[model samples]
Target: MIQMKCRVLLFVKKNMPCVKMMKLSPSPDLNPLDYAIWSILMEKACQKPHPNVESLKRALKKAWKGITLVDLVKIVDNFPKRFQACIDANGGHFE
Candidate 1:
């Protein structure tokens, strides 16, 4: 009986979710250009077009390492145009 009780307690403890570590301070300083680029990516993400989300996630992840500020701005600025063209070609807005 004691062994079964101990096993149950151990199982419960093991199944409990771990607590997340909270940040104690603001993130290290980001360059203005970096901030701008990240802001653009975030704004686009919040629109949450499901079909594009995966592609956008991949692009943004890649952008994090390889892209410069200018590239990011260009991508962000062109997003609306690309989206609009798709809509036009499809004959209507995305439902």
Candidate 2:
């Protein structure tokens, strides 16, 4: 696993020299997708069971369309407060 990670890092460094990489931790407070988007998508898309993969895909697409620009803006605009909360917890989990 470590070797694969090193290989991926090397590949990224070689292919994307301008990109800066940092170690990432799993913290929903720092990731808008985890904190908000996924739940919204799941709630909207998974309200009923789908008979097959295509049905699920269609449902997800519909749910995605239901998300408005204003909703997205609000989610992004709330990032500073999330960041501050994460910081207040000293990089630990926050509620």
Candidate 3:
């Protein structure tokens, strides 16, 4: 595991110099958008069979248009509570 981590860090430092300078101590949580908006979008987009790439893209676009600022703000507002839950759980995964 230590060797694997070292290899990963080495690879990051060599190939992903932009992210190499980022702190390695604490990991980040999942994006709130993934938890909130993405699920709704996926549900709407996949509600019916697309049958073609264009249809799928159209469905996704429709879903994207459905997202409102209020939805985003609600997700963003919940971030602190979600993060606190993670901290309370000693960095374990939280809903």
Candidate 4:
């Protein structure tokens, strides 16, 4: 009876989710929006004549409600060359 109880306890512990206990350490000294804005600015900076950072920021703020992940992906897809260049230069895979 004791062996059976131990086995059941072990199985329950093994199947339990530890998501709440997972550490969600934010990057030191940087806010979450900083990363997103920086990425957008970097991509904009690579274009000819460069883009207005304030205008991009304004657009982002205004479009925040309507934009979704699929919209962002479509924007990237529309700029295949630039997107590919960004991925290659940054050593990151987007797809």
lDDT of 2: 0.74
* Candidate 2 local lDDT, 1-95, one digit each (tens): 34544555576667666646655437767776788878888999999999999999999988877876656657756766887888898998888
Best by lDDT: 2
- The residue-level lDDT of candidate 1 at 22 comes to 31
Candidate 1 vs candidate 3: the TM-score winner is 3
Q: How does candidate 3 score on lDDT?
A: 0.67
Stretches of model 3 off by over 4 angstroms after superposition: 1-29
lDDT of 3 by residue, 1-95 (tens): 34544554575567655543443234346455556767878998999898999999999988888876556556645656876888898988766
Q: Tell me the TM-score of model 4.
A: 0.23
Question: Is 1 or 4 the stronger prediction by lDDT?
Answer: 1
What lDDT does each candidate get? 0.47, 0.74, 0.67, 0.43
Q: Rank by lDDT, descending? A: 2, 3, 1, 4
Quality of model 4 by C-alpha lDDT: 0.43
Ranking by TM-score: 2, 3, 1, 4
Error of 3 at 45 (Å): 1.3
lDDT for position 43 in model 2: 96
The residue pairs that clash in candidate 1, if any, are none
Cα deviation of 79 in candidate 1 (Å)? 0.7
Best by TM-score: 2
